[model samples]
Target: MNQVIELIQSHRSIRKYKDTPLTNEQVETIIQSAQMASSSNHMQAYSVIGVTDPNVKKRLAILAGNQVYVERCPLFLVWCADLHRLKVACSLQDTEMVAGTTENFIVATVDTALAAQNAAIAAESMGLGIVYIGGIRNNPKEVAKLLHLPELVYPVFGMCVGMPDHDPGQRPRLPLELIYHENRYDPEKAKKGIEEYDQMMRRYYLNRTHHSRDTTWSKEMAAIMRQPNRKHLRSFLEGQGFRLE
Candidate 1:
């Protein structure tokens, strides 16, 4: 297999990191790779904030569901879906713009995600470990305030990047056939794959090198879907000027 393909296959979410800090040149290279990611209509509807200050990271750690890694990591980044620039484009033409609709929200959010993923892959390629911090949304308002974000911009997620203190084995993924159907959908085949996957996950959770849990994929998913997760996000988005319409 090609080097890039091998890198892709061995992806892991790294939490424990060494105290080593990334050089400014390395940070620039990673952000440049992220900028190369495809964007909707080239709007690039995203901005990234790199945080290294201890005080800022401490507050962010608290705001982001008390994820200690946010404060401990040598590099922390917040990826924001931003429509504020588009408004500038409109103003340059002496015209007003409206982007509060659902479609606009989706486009900007997706652009931010695609860019952040490229940065993550770049970090992994350079032997740096990284973890995505979705808990930024646990208190989006507080996060935005902490980041000093402007209107029409929102923090989609944060990322912690640093040198790995130790290697963590790769986690298992769903069966390929279940995810990749060629001609038509196959519910029965997908169902069987999931059933088999559940057992694999049960063994994995029980046997992994860290804190062990007795659980299966299906059981975890059921528990997750049983509740309305991040229910406040709807109101939060609205408060950020993203209209559901």
Candidate 2:
């Protein structure tokens, strides 16, 4: 297998890190890898802000559902889905842009996520560890305030990057048979696969994390669906100027 393939296969979310700092060259290399990712229509509607200040890291940690790793990592990068620059350009020319629409928002978000994943893969190839913090969405408005983001921009997610001080066991994923379908979709086959994978995930999590009881993946997912934790996401997105319709 190619080196990148091997890296991709072995990738895991790392939460611990050594106190070592990344060299300037290594940082630049990772950023360049992110920049090289394919953009939707070559709009490049994204930006990455590297946060190094201790105070800022602490605030981000609090905002990110108290994920302490955000403060511990040597480098914290907040990737943004940005249409602000293009909007400003158009405005300067006395033109109107429809970047505030739902379609444009989806494109920018997808573009940012693709670039961030590329950066993650590149870092893993170089023996660096990384984790993506989705909790940046927990308080999007506050996060935007903290980042000083302008209108037409939203923080897609935050990434913590550093050399590993500890190697956590790889988390199990659903079997390929469950996820990949052939020409036709088979609900029964997929359900069976999920059942088997849920058992495997229970064992994996019980052995890996701090939880006392084994929680099957299907059960957890079902519970989340029932809880409606993210029911406000649509309203939040609308408040951020993203028109879902």
Q: Give the winner by lDDT.
A: 1
Give residue 53's error in model 1 in angstroms: 0.7
Q: How far is candidate 2 from the true structure (C-alpha RMSD, Å)?
A: 1.7
Q: How many residue pairs clash in each candidate?
A: 0, 0
Summarize candidate 1's per-residue lDDT along 90-146 as a digit string, tens digits. Answer: 999999878888889999999999999999999999999899999999999888888
Give the poorly placed runs of model 1, Cα more than 4 Å off: 209-212
Ten contiguous residues minimizing lDDT sum, candidate 1: 203-212
Please tell me which predicted candidate would have the highest TM-score against the true structure: 1
Alpha-carbon lDDT, every model: 0.91, 0.88
What's the residue-level lDDT of 132 in candidate 1? 97
Off by over 4 Å in 2: 209-211
Clashes of 1: 0
Displacement of residue 173 (Cα, Å) in model 2 is: 1.1
lDDT of 2: 0.88
TM match of model 2 to true structure:
0.94
